[model samples]
Target: MAVHSSDYPFSAFPSPLTTSPKVPNPESQTPSPAAAAAAAHGGSAKKRKSGLIECQEPQGGGNSAGESSLDLISWLPDEVLGTVISLLPTKDGARTQAVSRRWRPLWRAAPLNLGASSDLTDQDQKRLVFVSKILSDHPGPARRFSLPCMRLRDRYAKINGWLRSQTLTGLEEIQFGYEIEDPLLHYPLPPSALRFAPTLRIAYFGYCDFPREMAPLLKFPCLKQLNLCGVIVLEDVLHSLLCGCPVLESLLLEGNVGVGCLRINSPTLRSIGISVSCYGTRVENPILLQDLIIEDAPCLERLLPLYPIRGPLTIRVVRAPKLEISGWLSDSITKLHIGTTVFQKMIALSLTTSMRSTVKVLALDTFGPNLDSVVDFLKCFPCLQKLYIKADLQKSRKNKWSYNPLDPIECLESHLRQVVVMKYWGMRPDVDFAKFFVLNAKVLKKMVFGCINNCNDNWMANQHRRLQLDNKASQGVEFKFRRGSCSISLTHSRHKQDDPFDSHIFADDA
Candidate 1:
C-alpha cells in the first residue's frame, strides 16, 4: 500500500537522449514498417525525431498487428487504462500524456485523486497551479482531494473557484485543513463545494469556521464519514448538519469550539467520537456542555469521548438496544475522568442494567492493577472478550480483592481472549497482577506488556523470568513486549473482532 514517487505510471518512459533508433538488421529477409521507415529516414535521422515519435511509431504496416506489437498496453480497454492511471498521484497521472497520444485521452478522463502536503517545498503555489491545470484542462470526475495543513490565505479564491467547478461532481472524499501555526486565521468553507458533490461520502475539515447562513443547505445525502477537527461551529448548526445526513455513520469532532452540547438521534449512526478542549482558550465564553443524549440510534456501536469532560456532564444512552462498545464509561460524573472509581461505577451500572451482556470491549486507565477490584470490575461484563488496560505500574500496590482459590470470574474462564497492557513497568504489583491472569483466565490467548519511558535489560529479563514461572491456564497464550520512547503496546493474539472506536487517550497526551 506504500506508494513511491518513482513508481508513477509513466515515470519509466525513456528520455530522448537515452532512446536509440531501432536498427533494421540488413541480414533479415523482411523488415518491419518502422524499420523500413527508419532505413528510409536513415538511423541518425530517426534518432533526431524525439523519443515519443520513435517509441510510438507503428511497426510493420500500422495495422492491428502493428499497433498490438508496438504498444500492447495501449490496446487495453479504456476502463482498465483509467483504473491504472487513477492509482497514481494527480501530477504523476497527468504526466502520462507524454507516454503516447493514446494515453493523453485516458489521462484526461481518469478519476482524479489530488493530494498536496504542507511539507512539500513551495507547495502552496505548486498546488494552486497543479489543481488549476488539472481542473481546467481535464474536466473529468474527481475521486478524492486532500490539502492538509496548507497556507490558504492567498489562494482561497482559486480553491473556492475549483470547488465550484463541475469537474468535482464525482468527488467521494475531501480533506482540507489550514496551517496549524496560524490559529487565529479561519477559512470558511464555500457552500457550493459540498452542495455540488452528491457523491461525497467522506469529508474532513480542520480550522474552518462554518457559515451559519448556509446551514439549511448543508445536506449531504451520501456522506457516511465526517470529521471536523479544530473547527468552530455552533451547536445548532452542527445539529442541523447532522440532521440532513440521514445515513451518517462515523463522526469525529475534536477540539471544536462552538458546540457545547451534542444530541444525536440518527438511527444509522454507529460510531461517534468527541474530544472537547478543556483549556478554554478558543471560545470567549465556551458553553459547559451539560448533556450528550443518544436517542433512537439502535445501531450505535462505539461512543468515544476522548478527553475528560470539564464541568458537570451527563451522558444518556436512550433507545440504543444494540449499543455495545463505550469508551471511558463511568457511573458518577467527577469531571468525567478515567480511574478505578470511574470503571467500578461503570461496571456496577452495567451489572444493574441489561447492558452487562451487550458490552463486550472495555478500555480503562488505572493507577495500578488491584486484583480484587479488577476481578469484581470484570465480573459485570458477562460477555467481555477484549480488555485494554493502561496502568502506571510504578504506583503503590494495593489488593482490593480477597484471594479465593475456589471462585473465579466467568469471563476469564470463557470469553476473554486478548489483553493489552500499556505503560507496564517491572514492579511487584505489575508482576503479581500479571501472574493472577497467567494462573487463571482459561480462554486467554495473548498478553502484551509495554514499557514506554523505561525499558532496561534487567527489568525486561526479571519480568520475563517472573511471568514464565507461573503456569498459564491457556497453553495458546503468547506474550509480546515493546519498549522505547513510544507507548508500550502488548497483545497476545489476533482476533477478527470489529473495534469501531480507536483509542486516542494515550495518543492525545503522548
Candidate 2:
C-alpha cells in the first residue's frame, strides 16, 4: 500500500549500513590466542558483554539481543506503524499485547484500521469487551481508532461518552464506519474534545452531515488537504469553509450537491481539481478565480472542464501566457465548428489586411470548403506547426470538395509538419485528399487517417494497403500516411447530428 524506506533497520544506523554487513577484517598479523579462543566459543562470547558500557569500549554498545530486536521492526515508521497494526486481524493484534509493554499501549491507543469483515460477532464482542476494558484501564490518547462495518448504534451513547472523556489528545486519524437504520442523533463536540487535538490532520465524512459551524468545530487553520465527495452542503457554504481553511492547499470536489461558480482565493492554494455534470441549465457565473490561479503557473497546470458547454461560452483570457489546449476542444466554440464559415470571415478580414496572427492552433472537423480562402487567412500565422482536421467525404448539398490543395496550405509546407484527420471513414474522396496531402506536403512527416468502427475491416485493410504502397514508393515524397482506429465515430445508425451553428463559428469569440 504505502511505500516504506528500503534501508529498514539499517536506516537507524549511522555511517555503516547495509542489507548484508561485510565480515570483520582478519585480526592483526600476530593474532592474540585469546581472540582465537573467543571466536571458538561464539554462543557464550556475546553473553559476557551486557548493560550500559562507556562510549570508547569495543563491545560496549553493540548487543546481539538489541540489534536483533531493532532489525525486526526496521522499516516501521511511527506514521505507518498504526496502519500495519490496523490491517492485522483483531485476534492477531490483541495477541501481540503480551509480546512487549511498548506494544501493549499502542495496540490499544493507535487508531485501529479494522477490515471490512471486522464487525463484532457474538464471541468477538466478548473478546472486544475484555480488550476494551484492558485498554480503558490504561489511559492516554489513541493515535488511531478505526472500526469498519460496525453496527454500534446500541452502544453509541456509551461509545460517544467514552470518546469524549478520553479526548484523543494526539489522534492523527480516526476511521469509523456505522451502518444504522436511522440517522444518528446530532452530537455537539465539546470544546475540550476539539482543543485537545493538536496533531489531527485528516478526517473523512461519509454519509455524515456537518453542523452549520463545522468550520469552527474543525481546527481549519491546521488542515492542508480537504476532500469533499458525496457530501451535502448549502450553496456557497463549501466555498466559505474553504476560505476559512487558510493553510488548505489541495481541494477535490466530486458529486457535490450545490453546484455553481466555485469562488476560491487562498494564497496557500496551489492545486485544485473539480469534475461536475454540466448538462443542466448553465450557471450565470460558474467560477471567478483570481490571484491564486493566473496565466503563469507551471505548478497549477491542469484545467479540467468536466461539464459540457451548455450555452454560448466566452473565455476572456486577460493574459494567460502559458495556457494551451491539449484535449478535446469544445464543440460549442462557434469558430472551430464552423469550418467554412470561419474561412469566409477570415477571407473578409484578409481583404482588409486587418486580421491578427494571435490564434496559433486551428483544428477543423471538416476541411472541405474555402480551403484557399482559409489559407489566405492563416497566412498571418508565421509560426504555425500543427493543423488538425476532419473532412466529410460525402458531397454536400452545395457542391463536391471545392477546396483546392494548391492554393492556401501549399505555402505552409515549411510551417506545418503534421496534419491529423479525425473521423476518417474509408471513402474514395478522403483517400484522394490523402493522396493530395502526401504529394504536396514538403515538410510533412505524418498524415494520420483513422477508421470509424472495428467492424470496418475493409476500411482498415484498404488503409493498410495504402500505407504499404506509400511506404514502398520511388518518385513520391517521403511523408508517412499512418492509418489506425477512428478518433471519434459519427456512424450512429441514425441521422447525423447537426449543430445549431453552421461551420466557421469562432469559439474564442463565443
Candidate 3:
C-alpha cells in the first residue's frame, strides 16, 4: 500500500526540474531591498526569491501590497506533482489544468483514479457529460474506475460508449453499481471492455447482466477477486466465467438467480461467499440448489452462506486439509447448527486424537432439551475458555436441567473464564443455567446477562438479586448486564492469529 513518487514518473519530463534559482554568495553581492526586508522580518534572504514568501513590501512604501509571486509548487518534480494531483478529487484534479501549462500534462500522465456519482450534482446529464469528457481527453489506461450509487438507466448507452473507448489493459480495479431506482432492472455490460482487460485484479458489478454469447471468450487471467451482486446471468454463463478465471482467490455472489448449484474447482481459491434468493412463493420449488462442491483448493480457508439453506443444501470439501484448523476442530467456528448425527461425529473425532483441541470459543443458538448432550460436546475441547448461550425463551421455558450436580464438567471447573447468557428473561431454566456456571466455574472471571426482550429495570434487578444469592466458586468473577443480544465472535481474543475465513462471514451473514 506504500506509494512512492519514484513509482509514478512523468513521461514528458525525463529529468528532474526545480523552480528555485541558484543563490549568489552572501559576502560577494549586495542584498536586494526584498532580501533586506526579509532579513529585518526574521526570514532568510534566499527564502524570498524561492517563492517561499507570500508577499513583498510595496516598492515605494505604498499602502497596497504587491500581488503574490508565482507558486513554487509548479516547479516541483513531475513525480511529486503527479502524486499530489492523484490525491485530489476528479473534478478538482481536472481544474488544476488551468493553474499552469506544466500542470496540464501532469493530470493526464498521473495514474487515473476516476470516481463519479450522479448524486454529487443536481443535473445528471451534466455529470454524465463531464465524465465522458474526462474519459475522452485521457486515452491512457486507468488504475481504478468507480461509478457507484448512480442512476444509469437512461444513460446506459452513454456508459457503454465511454467504456468502449477506454484502453483497459493496465486497469487494476473497476466498480460499477446502479442506484436504488429500480430493483429488478439489469444494465448490460460492454463485452468488448471486459474481454480486453487482461490486468484487472478486482471487479464488482451491481444490478448488471453478463453477455451470454461472450461467456466462452471471457478470460481475466489476473483477476483475484470478483463480486457479482444483484446480477442476472445464466447457469452455464456463470460457470464459464468462473472457469476462465484461473487464479481467482475470492468470489462473492449475493441475490443472484438462474444458478441453482455452484461447483467450484479452483486450486488457488481461498474464500467464497454466497447468498441466494428463493424464486417463488411456494416452498416446494425453493431454489432447487443441490450442492456447493469445492475441490482441489488446498489454500481454501473461508466458506460462508448468507442465509440458512431451506432445501437440500450440501457443502462438500475435497483435498482441503486446512479447511479445519486442526483435525476436525475449527478455530473460526463461531456459530454451529448441529444435529444428533453431527454431534456424535464431533465426539468421535475429539476422542481419536489429543492434538485436535481447537474449539476455544463456542456460541450455541439453543441448548436443546438434553443438558447432558451439551455437556458431552464441551468435554471434547480441552482448551475451552469462553461460552455464549443464545437461549430461545420458548424452548428453554419447557426444558429442564438434567445434569448430575455431583460430577462437574472439567472446563467449568478449570478452563472456562467468561460466560454470556443472551435473551435472558429470568425464566426458571435460564436462572438455573446462570446459577450453575456461577457456583461451579472456579476460573470464571466475567459473566454477562444480555436482556433482549420482555425485561425491564425491575425484572433485571430481581434477577440480579437472585443470582447473587448463590456463592460463586471464583471470588473475582465480575457480573455485567447489557440491553442488547449477543453476537458470535468470528475471531476471539484467545486466538489473535489471522484467520482468512473471518472476512467471508460478513458477506454470508448479510
Candidate 4:
C-alpha cells in the first residue's frame, strides 16, 4: 500500500496532539520496513488520531468506556473526594447515574455528612438518591445519616426500607426532620426497623408525631440521647415512651406541642435539658408542667427545668448531687436561671432544700415580692461567690417592705465577691444594691454595672460616674460599667396597649 500525503493530512492529527505509539508516517520518502508495517496499521492510527483518542472530551467530559471502567468517586482520593462530592447537592450528585455504571455505584459510596440546616432546594433530591442507593447497596450500616426537610411519603418509605436494610449493619446516628401531614401514614417506623436500630445512639426528631401505641420504642433500648423539637406528642404516650428507654441519658424538648407535667423516670439519665414555651390565646388555661417526679432518676446530675408552665417546679432532687438549670423559675426551688419569677417560687424552695449549703453562681432577674425571700435565698447559699442580678430596673416589680428591708440581708454586702448589675439605669434600688455591696463585701474584687439602656439624664449618668469615682477615692472598690453587652430595645407587653415598658414582663425562658 503506497500511502500518500493527501491520504492523511496534518489536520487529521489529534488536537493537543501526542506522538506516543511510534507510528512512522508513510508519506516519508524511504520505504522503511517499520514505516510500511506502520502504514498497514495507519487506519487504526488515523481512527486513534481522530477525536476518539481523547481520554475525556472538553465539552462532554468522561468517555463511555472510561466512564464505565472508572469509578468517578473511586478515582477520587478517599479524603479529598468526599469533600468534593459533598458540594454537589444530592440531586446533582445523583446525576452521576448517567455518567457510567461505575460512577453510578461510586456516587452511592460517598459518606453522608448531614448538617443541621433548614435550607433545602429542589436539587437536593439527586444527592439524596445517591445517598439512598449507596446505603441500600452498602454491605454494612451507615454511621451517620441526615435527612432534613424530607416531606414526601415515598421518600419516607424508601428511607424506612434503607434503614431496615442497614439494621444488621448497625446504624450509629440518624437525624430526621420532616413536616408531618398524615401522621399515621407518613411517620410509621416498622417494628423490624426499630428492633434492628438498637445501635442508634443519637436521634433527633423535628415536627414529628409519635402514635399513642409507641410500639416502635420497644426496639430502641440502646437509644441514649433523644432531641424532640417542635413535636406534638400525646401525654400518656410520652411517659410510656420515656420510661421504656431505660438507658436514655440526655433529653431535650423545645416548643409547645401540649406536653403537660413530664414525669421522668430514667435511671441512667445524667443530664436533662428542656425548653418549653407557652404562648397562649385569650383563654387562659392553667399552665401545667409535666410532673417531673425525682424519685425515678437516682443518677441524675444536671437538671435544666426551662420555661415550664406558670407553676411551682417540684423536682425532689434531694437525692441527685449537682443541678444546672435555666429559664423562668418558680420559688419552689432556688438555683441558677434568668428572670424574677424564681422569687415567686422562692417560698417553696425555702421549705424544700434548706439543707443545701452552697450556691456559687446566682443570676437574679430583679428582686421581687419579698426582700426576705431574697435574704432567704442568700442565707440558704451561705458560701455564694458570684452573684449576677440581670435586672431591668425600669421594669422592677413594686412591693412595700413591711420590716427593715435592708437590715436582714446586710450580710450579702460583706460576703459576696463578684456582683453584676445588668440593665442598670442607676435607679435608687440599683444604687442601694451597689452601695450595699461596696459597704458589706469586705473582700469584694469587682462590681460591674452594665447599663444596656443609655441614661442621658446628667444626674443618672453622674450617679454611676460618682460611684466609679468614689470607689476609686476610697479603699478603691473597683467599679465599672461595660456598655453594649445587652440590647436596649423595649419588650412587647401583653397587658397595656399604651405602655410598651411592662416591668412585670417575664420571658418564658426566664
Clashes of each: 6, 16, 1, 21
lDDT of 2 at 324: 26
> Tens digit of lDDT per residue, candidate 3, span 1-510?
332333222222222212221112222243422232233443333443454354544122222122224333443456555655554555544445544445556678877767665422345665676566667677666777777766866776777776776544477888887665654455566674474447889888776666789888778899998888766677888899999998898787766656776777888887666655653332334344445666666676555553433222454444453442211122122222221113331222233322123445554445432344345555654566776666455544443454455875678777888876766666676777677677777899988776665456787678867776358889999887666554443221212224321222122110
Tens digits of per-residue lDDT, candidate 1, 35-93, equal: 33344445433343443354554322223434434443443446655766665555555
Give the whole-model CA lDDT for all candidates, comma-separated.
0.61, 0.39, 0.56, 0.47
Single out the weakest 10-residue window by summed lDDT for candidate 2. 492-501
Residues 1-510, model 2: lDDT tens digits = 222323111112233222212112222242222232244443443443331132222221223444433322222333333444444444344333433333344455545432223332334354345334434543544554544334554666655544564535565554444443453342222233234234555543333333455544444666665555434455556656766676665555544444444544455654443434321222223332211223333332223322323212322222332222211223332222111223222232223221133333444443442244334434544344555555545643122233445664433556556555655555555555554445555566545554454525565567656544454322333333334433432111111122111122222120
Candidate with best TM-score: 1
lDDT of 1: 0.61
Runs in model 2 with CA error above 4 Å? 1-167, 174-198, 216-218, 277-299, 305-459, 465-510
Candidate 1 regions with alpha-carbon error over 4 angstroms = 1-72, 118-121, 180-182, 278-282, 288-291, 306-314, 323-350, 354-357, 370-373, 403-408, 452-469, 484-510
* 1 or 2, greater by lDDT: 1
lDDT of 4: 0.47
Top model number, lDDT: 1
RMSD of 1: 10.8
- Give the higher-TM-score candidate: 1 or 4: 1
Better of 3 and 4 by TM-score: 3
Ranking by TM-score: 1, 3, 4, 2
Give residue 216's error in model 2 in angstroms.
Answer: 5.7
